[model samples]
Target: MTEFVRVLLPLAPAVPLVLALLGLLLRRPTSLLPLAALPGLAAAFVSPTGEIISLPWLLLGISFRLDPLGAVFLGFASLLWTLAGLYAYAYLGGKQGEGRFCLFWNLTLAGTSGTFVAADAATFYLSFALLSLAAYGLVVHERSKAAWRAGRVYIVLAIFGETCLLLGLLLGANAADSLLIDDVRAALAVSPWRDAAILALLMGFGLKAGLVPLHVWLPLAHSAAPVPASAVLSGVIVKAGLIGLIRFLPIDALPSWADTLLWLGLATAWSGILLGLPQRQPKAVLAYSTMSQMGLMVAVLGAGFGAGVAGTTMATALYATHHGLAKGALFLAVGVVAAGAGRAAIPLLVVVAVLGAAIAGMPFTGGALAKLAIKDSLGSGPVGLLASLSAIGTMLLMLRTLVLLVAQRPPAAVAHASAGLIGPFVATAAAALVVPWLLFPVLTGRPLAYAFASPVIWDALWPIFVAVVIASPAFLRSIAVGDIAGPVEAVLRRVGGSWTAWHPPRPAIDGPRLLTRLVKPAQSLETWLAGSAASGSALLLVAVLLGFAALI
Candidate 1:
């Protein structure tokens, strides 16, 4: 039985991939597609921890494993994918392009499941690339101009991140002299190229993790993709990067790098909140919140790295699990609340708000337990204070989400939620609340007693109280980067028009005339600098000429 279960671990992902291939041959079977996630769900519960499955016959000796850390991530990621599958079934029903959507759906599912279990560098990168690329199909499923734009940006970054991962892997493999993840990190600790390798890994994974500037694709992709796809994207896809950082970086080996990570995480944490404050779209708000939540998770990992503690891995996973499930639920609620009416609306709104608050570390919630789990890792100092402020900002973000959700309620008579749609969300929301409590003991080795302690509860509540005290209706209004960009674009357009009006295309002159005479040299210089090779030569020539003139 033990051996059989171990074999089934890799099969979890293999099942969906097989289904995806089968989908290519047969008619689109909508009803059967969601069942593809069942194997992953089973693997999450039944796969023995610390078991490794190596396949020398496949993908150049690929390996998969289920250590406690991977299992923590695997559990929630599988759960979210499963729920998103069911939700997609209902959400995409009778819609156009169902077949194509189903294909990408299973392909993405396979990649997501495979990524969690992958134990080797090559296998992890393959799975990561697979999901990152496959999701481009999902992002562009609607084929709207916006969807295409999002897809273009997503694919560009996905390729860029993959390139980074490739370089990092090459450097890491060379340093470690092994392909296994553990061996790579072990070798990385002592390698001469450690800093370069780490920087490469950070940029590669950080792009996927939605670290700032790289994060612009997130809101665009989330808002453009379908609801169920949005849930998985926000909830599970970003966790790939989290898992990457967790697996690749040697927390015990680099304290200075860890401090660098701490500041980066802090900046990402606050940047998301500040940027999200002005966004009006519910999905966009949730997207930025995903970035904010990821920032917190990165901070946990940084703190762990700084302290050179191995146990902080579990803390990071716990925090990620909580955020993953809650954010997934919140994204799904956007669809549910929009589709629901009257009395059902209020209850749905309440449920959404509760889950959102969980992201903000509401008392008696998984978020609270997650906060408590990592308290020691963060330390009660300036970083801790900033973490607290991040929590309050999360409260504001969630509050803004709830207000937006309430505003989406239909004006018609009360209509109950579809069993198809609401069922997955409610189950996810329930898991978001219950699973953390169950896993807290196992993940952290702390007794359940510590969770319910008054001090812990109070520590969680104060952030919520502060957020509530400062929050207002006006503050909840939708704001976005476009607000600033919109005006800037207008100004640029006016300037360009003025420049064009002034210049007026030089009147087709063969030789340089009055206005064109002075501009001729500048245009020649501009054209010369525009050439890649010429630009370098031009600078050197200018330097030589200046030096010669100086000598004279």
Candidate 2:
């Protein structure tokens, strides 16, 4: 690496983090949030594959590297975050809590960017922790009852995921007898506790990636967050879990594990569609769309890994990039329609149609490229056919989502597209349209001509046609967003209400008052511990314990 690139590597994540603190002091509007992410974007372009930059002075001798996979993740993620940040300005500029939102937004940006580059386990964990924890602010930025509830579920699941991840990392590192990420991943295959480590990793990263049963928090969190936050949560943040699986799982060394992931991912893919079909909220449907898309990503990962395919990382990264840009744009488009894009709502819907097609892998779009990148690994057997059928389900979901969004469009006379939303939204949409063609050849080393072949085009087109034919208003159902958690939440609420309605018979609170007075100080301590900042520290403590559990 050149001296310039070497210096630029660490600065990518560091710059935004420093600016985030400064922005907090300055109290900038939401629009300025995009400026903080600029450096990371610049680094993305110059990130040379196989380049490494070490900072021995940093926490436990951290190192950063830009391999092919890292480069793709960093570049596209930076793009999504920056655009989403600008869109946030339009969505919530000068609003109350804008400062807090900006802080956590940039902090999450730093954390995610760091995760893409870190070469050491400690650096990766810290970055992942920052990404996981700071995002809570975004989830609850509105502070409404729903937002708080979502925040609670998100933080709990986040802590759980991180705990599993931390323990897995520790086990891998201990087995490797090295702190380096590559060393630890290689050692996982040889570890005495290999099965336990892999289980921990799947539980942790699987939760973040929204794989099947672990996806309870996702739909609720996305629907509860603000538009821009939901965009990142779905598009950029989930990729953190994906990259974890790619970087650490050692798929080539353990084919059985890859097979396990294959089935798990397939289950998530189908389930997300089934559950999302019933969602009333547009964002909730998109949230489930994200879960399903993530399932596709992992499914591809498992197939490629099991096949011992070269360049699986790059191909998976390519798919991720395509999905991120398109899905992020789709979410922003929801905001535009919700804002009553006036005359533009129709035009925006046209764009949404095309975006949805891209997501469903229609011919001549980025999604097609993504599908092509992973096609060989999925093989031509039943597995491949089943995976292809997922496209039909995805298209149907998007079709329903479109119907919901159109229902939301305001009357032309009363509606007008907000100018601020258009710029970022268009940029994101354009990137999704254009970036895949640029990356596919480089990533997969395949000619673009393959994507346009008649067979390929027909294969992509049939599912979409089927989806259209099968879609009907009569079939739509709005199952409350939380899936399995829905009934559980209802039970808890019912029980709590019952307790409130039937207060236990209290003895003349004279004696109870004395008891309360004695524990008032304890209550005060409890209150202190309940604050958000304290909760975050407590999260870290839990991770440490989880790691220790692995060692034992």
Candidate 3:
């Protein structure tokens, strides 16, 4: 049994990875590419949790296992990748970059799916690195100027994040005296360099998670990346950092930092909403929403940490899983909304409304399931209150996104809409709606009916009502970065542009033009300089300067 599970675990990532390599030579085998994610999705369900497998010969000894925590990450990440791959195949059929897109798309899927199941620092780092680096291809796949710009920002920040992660892993593994992730985390409780290691881990993961100040990349990247790539980027890839923190941060040992993480999470949550509300495009709006949702997830982790709750890990995983499905669906729907026009778009739009509302924690939906799963850990305290408030902001952000999307006309660039394209969007929406409800009872150890009780339903509804009221003319008619980095990324391009604009020189140096106009120095001077007279004068000058300095 153990051997069978081990083989299956590695096959999850290996299948897609091999496909990615083979895709280079194949003639646009996109239809078959969607199956690459099948192994990962199967792993999420079939691979027994805690059945760890080690590859001693592979890159400093890497290992993999699927714990309860990993299952959630793997389940959602794999599901999103599968659906997005399917959508991409249909969306880009006969398009120019289909072959190139398929290659990176599978590569990214392999990395993301691997991160969840990774059991050692080496495996996690390499998987995380592959996801981070290979995604550059997806971002710049369009080869547009904007695509290139987003790719540049994504890569630059990605490199910095890699450095921080490597440092943290090195210090952590050294302290633990083991390459296994569990051992490293266990050592974090008492390691002499705990603070340094934690700081590096947070920065490295936080940057990828799109936390405030480091989040500028999300907006540009999402807006520029193709719809399928954007779906995975926002949906699954960003969660890499969150999972890293979950795996490595010794939150149980260093509970002192709980409030710190909590506040940072809240700040990120609201920052995303504030920035997203003003966005004119659905993609940009969703990008900021990703930031806010990620922040709230962090805040949940922190709150659970501070409270010393048992379910912190599970609660966070649940939240991330829910967000991944809903957000991915929303991004993919961007394509659906643009492709479906007039009356045809109405059903798709309705699905969008449900998914958006679910994001806002609407009652009896996936977001409600997420909120319910976490509320026990959060309690009815200030942090919970703040989290609830952020839901209102999310409601507004989604409402804005819906409005913007509704306004888009059918773009001619897309092939006339097909079932292949719309099917994935609908399937994702259905999965987002159905899967969690099925899992909630088992994960929370509560009756499924507990979620749908009248009071529980009301708690979810009020936020949606409040948000809608605010969106009304009376309140949110013109509704809305620690997150400053995303908005100012454009300014990075013109660094020193205005300050260094070509201004007349202030005569800081003697000009060659002035000297050139003067008659050339006599050839005699050159002749004399070649003699001992010039050499003696130069030597005397050096001697005088030395004597003068010594005297002074």
**What TM-score against the true fold does each predicted structure earn?**
0.86, 0.89, 0.86
Q: Of the candidates shown, which would achieve the greatest lDDT relative to the real structure?
A: 2
Candidate 3 structure quality by residue, lDDT tens digits, 268-353: 99988877887777898899999999999888888888888887788788788888889999999898777764456778888888
Give the alpha carbon lDDT tens digit for every residue of 276-394 in model 2: 98887789888998999899889888888898877777888998999999999999998888877876777888989999989999899998999888888788888899899999989
Q: Flag regions of model 1 displaced more than 4 Å.
A: 25-28, 413-416, 476-478, 481-552
How would the candidate models be sorted by TM-score, starting from the highest?
A: 2, 3, 1
Scored by lDDT, model 1 comes in at 0.80
Q: Which structure is stronger by lDDT: 1 or 2? A: 2
Counting clashing residue pairs in each candidate, in order, gives 4, 2, 5
lDDT of 2: 0.83
List where candidate 2 sits over 4 angstroms from the true fold: 490-552
TM-score of model 2 vs. true structure: 0.89
Worst 10 residues of 3 by lDDT: 473-482
- lDDT on C-alpha atoms for all candidate structures: 0.80, 0.83, 0.80
